[model samples]
Target: MIARLARQLGKEERDLQVLEAVLEHQPIGITRIARETDIDEHKARYSLRMLENDGLIEPTPDGAVATDDVEERVREINDGLDDLIDQMESLKDLDG
Candidate 1:
């Protein structure tokens, strides 16, 4: 089975919303993320748990500390998608 290392990248609308809120307010809690995102606390907690499991974030004595390199990870995803777009464009030449 292929480990979907990019779970959030696809089913991420909700997760992205939560991540953005967390990034802006690191060491925050599910209650805060829930309030800001209008998501229920349970959903917010689930998103945080998934992100933490992927090493994309963490929880500490203080609170949830988003991964320091989350932006970097986002960049990497963008770069990969850009590369994919370039590849697909190349294939369009054959269709035309």
Candidate 2:
């Protein structure tokens, strides 16, 4: 279970990396996103699709751009991660 959670978190991290690249460079393409984030082009493309589906980003003739909802979604994600961290801390306390 822990390993699965770790993998999920890693994927989330990678997706966020791709999102950051797009946020920094609006109208950015998958190839440039891969280069900027050091992620595989396929992986970046996958992340872009995921983000678009999540309404965090949109694709244009130029490239992918962050949506207005990006900031709100990021805040929710951060809050969820904080909650996960707290749960993990509680788990650690179980051994004490």
Worst 10 residues of 1 by lDDT: 1-10
Distance (Å) between predicted and true CA of 34, model 2? 0.5
Give the per-residue lDDT digits (tens) of candidate 1, residues 1-96.
125735645456677787888788888888889899999899888888877886778898766877878888878867987997798689779853
lDDT of each: 0.79, 0.93
Supply every candidate's count of residue pairs whose N, Cα or C atoms clash at under 3 angstroms: 0, 0
Best candidate (score: lDDT): 2
3-93 in candidate 2: lDDT tens per residue?
Answer: 9988998988998998999999999999999999999999999999988988999999999999988899999989998999999899988
- C-alpha RMSD in Å of predicted model 1 compared with the true structure: 5.1
Question: Residue 66 in model 2: shift from native, Å?
Answer: 0.7
